[model samples]
Target: MRTPIKRDDLESARSDLLATAVGWFKREQDVVGIFLGGSVAAGSADAYSDIDLRIVVQPEHHLHYVERRREIPTQWPGFLFNEWLPNTQHCVSHFQPFGKIDIFYYDAAKLTPSPWYRLQIRILHDPRGIVTDLVKRSEELPFLVGESDVDLSISKGLAAAHETYRRAKRGELFYAQTLLDELRHHVMQADDWLHDRTPETTVMAKFDNRASGEVLSSLAMSYCPCLDEAILAALSSLARAYRNQVLALHEKFQLSRPLRNDVAALDMVA
Candidate 1:
């Protein structure tokens, strides 16, 4: 059965699932701490939001847990399956009756927090006060992007759009579309820095909630149907938007706009 995006029963079921998971983690001797992140931690969760559960393991047993990360999520009721985020210790656990959870494993001894905790984290279990203290320290750190990062983001975005243009001209729509999507992320990162917000670890998530309408609207104008001509036009539009953003970022951060020559070369495309 398809679950409604917003429903009271689904909310109740999710709360119950979270409560049950909390109980299980608290009883497990090796599990040191538990905290929520993502939309749940930000207090903006809707019925469809996944429970981002950070599971802190006993430092001595961290390796053992990491080896069998799949075993942990399988313990949840109604668990359909879990998929690991590539090259990371995080898993997205999907369930049948109601909801989903993102389980992130952390080593208790090696716990080092960052500014991410300031925006998205709610501690539920911290017996040793380790996670609590780290979170407090992280919250004090400023969440601003560096000039080099902005330069890299805009340069790469423009480069990707150029690649997309080349691929579209060659009739490789799929690959062109792929690069176009990558360019979108580059735009998002640039936008984050333009407004002095920290770029999210998970790209393309919560951007709608955080970004200004002007940024979004400009990007929206670049979207087009998946036809060769349409895609070529989209690449052009995206390139123009990036150019404008480069100038804006230049004024805001005194960025060097190192991609001016590359962008000029890209604009020579028909």
Candidate 2:
């Protein structure tokens, strides 16, 4: 039977692997830099988290460097290993030793100005200055500057809100389904941008911090506005709460920027 790897087991294995790697580095005097990235470095590691490792070498040694480290994983068995050369200067290695490992390679100078630059990183060994320089450079890297389009939301939202007013004007139920759908999309899009995840939690509930009131009000007013006063009051409360959330994210991340309606407004909200 293949033994199952638990979170504790992965942590222990990483500790052991790092120990072995550090000893090898000390012996291999030419090896200049080593660092850890990915989930462990971010303090969000779990059993499924992969080890992200990087090693920097001297420029002259780049030609034969892959040949040198290719055998490193043989030190530990039961690991499923795969490796790739991302560029002439870099190699990426994946090792699933009871868990997963993602490794990167680079020369000392190539460490900076790479798109893979991560904010949170841990240096295992830096006999030369490459690791420190990369860390310093990462802090100064630019943040996201979103693209802009149009804010058709004002007209769209008001139109939908007016429809709900009409429904309320009639004796029928005041449902805000259409407005709710649009509102949900924008709120969800903003969350996706913030979390950097494709799928996020639901937009409902008082605990959901990312909801938007303008979106919600437009949604609610588009819905069953002709419903009883209590129902309308509840929808109004939800819209207000969602609006507060939009404002908060707007202040913190500049998420309120206008954008092309070409992309779904929700997708562009962030």
Candidate 3:
């Protein structure tokens, strides 16, 4: 479902979610702070959007506090619940049903703080101020890095090679359109990150900015044989660009996850 673009409606839903969360927390133990994070906090959300809420607790109670999450939305509207402890240095949990929620646990004496996080975050209620303070500390968190670098020249060279060896299959156009769409969205997100300073944008938005306004529109439509060479060229360019983009980040920040590694699949029409 497409989420609406209105800010007020989001805020209203936010207010409701916050109150519900706060009330739930009150029944458990010490709930130090509550905040807003993610797309809603960044002032961008769609009709099908979910909320991102962060619950902050005082020091010394980290483990005890996390244990209470399982029963959080028993009576509230929730579709998913996922908790993540990225590392031993800090404890963070994400809750999603109507939206997304992040709960940060902290010890005031153990750490200082930083300025911003990748995702937009705002303190809603911080009785002891630990939540806001922890937010500052988390900003200083260094990202992990990796070492493999996939050069664009290699990707481009491979693209040229593929054009010579592979026959134009029955689903070539379909495959081309899918790759074009993926490229468009990914590029748009890269632009949004650099342009708006917003950390997240839909994958589709990421590639939307890579090509000319017209070429993008055309790429989304059925592939015309006349443009086959051009489309292949673009895919090769993107694959190369992403290879380095992914590897460089992996080296610096250790950003490796289970993404499809099948470059050959890009050539497949299906």
Candidate 4:
């Protein structure tokens, strides 16, 4: 039988792994800069936060690191396993006694300012001032959610709601449920935009803590059993809620609704 990794132990393990990883990268001549990103950098990290390590390699040496990204973390203490993320230069490593790290290798020359580092970042190592310069340059980057994005998400959500209702009526529970899930994301994005939160930020991060009571209340009605009647009821509730969100966005951002269709499929959704 395996013993559980308690909250305290997990916290300690995480810190230990981070220190070791950062120390290793600092010793590498090809590593021009290093910084911490994600929730940990934002000061919102909980017991399970993964170490989001940004490793800036000397351009010519970047490919060498990318080729062996997965293998690099094996030298860290308590090495268990690691997974390669879609981006070849990114690697997600998991450790035995329990810890996780997301490492993204960047060529020093290609680093640019972006909204990603807008929240918070900790410079672990910046021998040549590369990471420091990136942070300074990123300070002026703004987060933008245009009118077109809000309109599309709202319109697409309503269309999905209509399709979900039809599918549920036809007894196709699987696809209906899938569409319901997708519709949740659409509304979530719309809600983020309406609240002036960056849509590209973490999905539903501390939702109950940050989201308005109205959004919370409507979101409650969006989840239901897989049964046809229940699914249809949920879709109806979500359809109206999506429309209300669109109206709110219009009032907030002065964005025009791109598509207002027949209410025959989704009543009161204009």
TM-score against truth, every candidate: 0.87, 0.50, 0.47, 0.83
Q: Tens digits of per-residue lDDT for model 4 on 85-155?
A: 55578999999677899999999989888866676788988888987877788878888877777767766
- What's the true lDDT of residue 244 in model 1? 70
RMSD to native for every prediction? 3.0, 11.6, 8.9, 3.3
Model 3 regions lying over 4 Å from their true place: 1-15, 26-28, 75-112, 117-120, 134-270
TM-score of 3: 0.47
lDDT comparison, 1 vs 3, better candidate: 1
Off by over 4 Å in 4: 1-3, 80-88, 155-163, 166-172, 198-205, 262-270
Instruction: Give one digit per residue, the lDDT tens place, for model 2 in 23-116.
Output: 7655665679888776577665666556777777777775566665555655554456656553443333444456555555576655556324
Which has the higher TM-score value, candidate number 2 or candidate number 4? 4
List runs of model 1 lying over 4 Å from the truth: 1-6, 198-206, 256-259
Worst 10 residues of 4 by lDDT: 261-270
Which scores greater on lDDT, model 2 or model 4? Answer: 4
lDDT of 3 at 177: 55
Q: Report the C-alpha lDDT of model 1 over 150-181, residue by residue, as the tens digit.
A: 76776687678778888988999988888988
By TM-score: ranked, best first: 1, 4, 2, 3
